[model samples]
Target: MLRALRSVRSGLHATYLESYFISQCDKLSSKWLTRGLHSAPAEDVAEDAGVTAAVGARSGERPNKSNRNQEVRPFTSIPGPKPLPLLGNKLFFTTIGGYPMERYWESVQRIYEKYGPVVKVERFSGSLDMVIAFRPEDTRKMFQAEGIYPMRPGLGILTHYRSKRPQWFSSPGLVPGNGPEWRRLRSVIHPLLRREVINAYRPAQTEVANDLVRAIAASNQHNTKQDPSRHIISDTLSILFHYTLEAVGVVSLGMRLGCLASTSANCQAQSIIKANIEVLNVLGESMLQPPLYKLFPTRGYRRLSAAQDTICRQVDVEVARRREELALDPEGFTQRHPFLASLMNNPDLSSQDVFLLLIETLQGGIDATATTLGFCLYFLAGHPAVQDKLLKEVQHVQPEIHTLQGLPYLRAVVQETLRLRPSAAARSRVIQEDTIISGYCVPAGTFVVSPPNVACYDPQIFPGA
Candidate 1:
């Protein structure tokens, strides 16, 4: 029965691949219908991938979903894992089998088992699609400098906004889409992400990290009897968010959020940032599945859209205020050290451009760094030996601001955490033209997903994947 099933599935895959290749050339019209799930469209197939795309996939069997003899371009020619009907290889991701995070990796590996290097999965609803890459080479293809493929827009809430003014709700730089305006913003703001600027931003980063340590220490001292490893004294993630936002604001506009000193956050910026976080949490899940998910709206979505407008308007106000300030004192303003001030001297940048760049940088850098800190803590709690080694390494350094440069083990821990808990689990690209990746002919605009989570755990690469 297994052999017969394989035979049937192979036939269907062949037809599917052939049909997709033809569709790419404008040779065939691949009419899509998402009724009762007869033919699972490519987008649906990608979403089913989820975290499995980000995490690595293990070996598994490919179930046959066809009764006819169809030939898919062999796996040797195409680069990704094999697909199963409607589900693609996503069914291999089993959420119930292991610890929450580990289970995600297990499920991903299962897809790799059946599919091979690159596998596609359908997220439940019309949320974005996913692609899991088993090989490092395949993964590297995604980071191409040319904007042929950029990041995915599946981060959810960033895409869904209810605002009257476009400027009011603009993301600036955080969300991903390709167009002339996006390109204009990217060109002017790209310099801020340069290596030197990231280095310049580190002083603020170290200050924040030290503040976090002190806060944690104070809490631990107060709860002397509690286990340091297990006690959740405070949310380090929240602290990091404020720190990053304030850091960006200081660097970009010479403004301060005053988050580090505040005992309780109550500012408008704080409220809006908090609300945005809530929206992200909601949109992230809501986007995972398709139209059926419409049956339920999570609290993240339930929050009145009007509040979102309030935040955008606040951003616009800041933009306008900065512009007026720049006009009134052009010479002194250009000399200012703030990020926005620095951009003022650049002929290519406008006030709107500066605002967008600053906002986007703040949005992208904050949650990602905070979440990363949390993941680092989680690992440190679980692996004391690693923590001890890191501490020892830190101690050997002079503890000066420059000391961070020579800390290898500290860097290793950070790298390991990033690998294990990437800020963005999956990176996506839209195929611009008909292309053959790993031998499969992918049509233009068909969302191509390559999850990085799997790369972190690959045993051949990471040794314990």
Candidate 2:
């Protein structure tokens, strides 16, 4: 059954790819012909016209040394959707439901296809101007030129919440801040999330995975006769959410919430999972829409506030419990969970700071890990051959708690999934200085977005995509 499904999907994908290429060829032909370069191929025309020059243009690359000091041109001259009197592309983004942040990749792709790679998009009545770059070369340049302290734009609602509760959160954690404060927090916790450190927690992670398998089996006991491909549990995302939250909780808080247990349905563990989902949903909406919460206490804003309080309160309780245990026997506490103990021991970070940090870490891990795992399962379910191969590899290794090495096929599956459907579809960076991207002058203070989805689909990079 799965094999049949795979065949159908492959046929559909091929059809789509063929049509896409044909459309692209038409676009290129028209563009080149308009320039009176119809005699040569589009690639040749692009090469002769120095289309790649914009990619490599930078301050130090100038041949004329005397011309390097001149002020660069502004980014306003870039072509984009024309702005109206008050609404700047906001109305275009609006639908019957709301702003489409959930489907942001689709929106970005529409803009990229319509206005070309380096198109400008204005939001919030032109208060926010963003330059969207789809080409891989432009993305490379943007990251390379990002200064010592690379600033990632985050949800504004989170910043507002943190500010309201100043006593609890002294500064925004890694997600919502830049400059010295971000650097300081990142420096303190960076080592804890390093590759080696995370690898050490593999034993705990495997235990959680095992628990998840049991939970799924128990939940689907009544539907055992159903075809594996058509099983209801296969389509449900809640199981993945629970599994990821439990796994991340164990790693972050040095304890399990039993989120995978059958009896955890109405418990505090379940409540925490629900709160995390709500926070993400509310924050995503708040980020795309107007900040009406500041002017009036809106329902979304209120819900976000409640979710934040729930998370912070729970984290505080856990931190207090750990502190009490550490005071009782510091040596034993350090032996059990040295990673978390080390963070608690840091002199610079207060209790509230540690709580806020844990909240950010857990929230970040839950959504990304869950989404990735969900995609992996979806892909593997459709490709039983690959699944069988992976199973054989796993069986051969008889992978122990912390021993996931020598799993090349498993690693490839993950890498390929990320390449195809990355958790972070688009990344934004605040440009600190004037820079040339694809021949366009993108000035400082402009928000620049690089869509990995666009680059990932490039035939040149990933042939046969």
Candidate 3:
């Protein structure tokens, strides 16, 4: 989840931060496994513009001015939610749950309102302290001044876990990687995201999406029988998640998880889905609280370890089966398992590295895609005129679920949904240079961040982008 997840500084809010996790180049802007999931809101994955921009930011447009000699005030001058003695903003953030964007955004809104645009959030009185710059101009400056190896303080718990087990992870397998090793792992994903790869795997995406439709239909039948007027599918989010998991599995795991079965979803499939939920919840917990587990194995750390172990074991079982299928028909493997085939066949990457990438992407992509789809449905339902236009488009392209093009209205609706409801409140980057952010000359190593919810709704900012 490297460059791909970074919301664009150029107009559109690309959904970043906790709302949107992981920024891998392969999670294609528009051309991902979730593409045909209701013909959802997607960036142009084949174009891979974000990947190129990310790589360029790291390789070409950097080695930025390290103004060690500049006449700037000390970094401590930057203001944020004040910290207590030996305990920074821990008390303030303990109540800030990372999910449900509005809840987290509410806290951020208060901070922005109190501290103006740029506020230094002193979390636990350590280097973990962050400076949030709330303007688009400031955000663009951070990216421009970000050095070659722009370091993001990704999941600290995840990085710590991987450090303890270097045998299984190659520089944390892109989730928390940095420098050359991070680039090496990221390189393999770039080649596999071409139009041919996306085109080859459209069947799998379409197949799972169709299964979702069937699941919805099946549920509607049961619901209509129970109460004639209650025709809607109960637990819509759960069904959507099943579809997203199966859709992502097509690429991430290179096999079906039976998540969208005609009858009941199998036990193993349900467990995998549950395991992912556990991982996301733990991640949110780690962010809310301090990382004391970094020093020794805390109970929370144990929970994270167990969840990660479950995902790893499950992925290995599926990967081993895929390898067997590949050995039987080597030539057909490329067409059948485009992404996996590339990863497994690569000499530079280890087997462990490949599994880590797939599992990470699977964990990273599913919930966000499903949630976005859900929001798209909610907004469409509320506005029948817009919904009717989209229905007409879907009908024109329907009968054949794979013919996804020519639906400008669907694309427009998805784009609008993401703009209105992004994946995360904000994304963070540690500035490597002494840069001016929101008029303050923020020194090197300060985290230049953004206020997530404020930017999207403010008419004066985007002016209906």
Best-fitting candidate, scored by lDDT:
2
In angstroms, give how far residue 109 of model 3 lies from its true place: 1.9
Model 3 per-residue lDDT tens digits across residues 101-198: 33677777777778787787776336466788776556666776678876777788888877776546656767677766777777777677676676
CA lDDT, every model vs. true structure: 0.47, 0.63, 0.62
Candidate ranking under TM-score, highest first, comes to 2, 3, 1
Off by over 4 Å in 3: 1-79, 96-102, 123-125, 164-167, 221-230, 262-265, 398-405
447 Cα displacement, candidate 1 (Å): 1.8
lDDT of 2 by residue, 374-432 (tens): 66566876787887776666654433331323556765666666666666756678877
TM-score of candidate 3 against the unseen true structure: 0.79
Please identify which of the two predictions, 1 or 3, would achieve the higher TM-score against the true structure: 3
Alpha carbon lDDT at 25, candidate 1: 16
Lowest lDDT block of 10, candidate 2: 11-20
TM-score of each predicted structure versus truth: 0.65, 0.80, 0.79
Backbone clashes in each candidate structure, one number apiece?
A: 48, 1, 17
Best by TM-score: 2
Please estimate how well model 2 matches the true structure, expressed as its whole-model Cα lDDT: 0.63
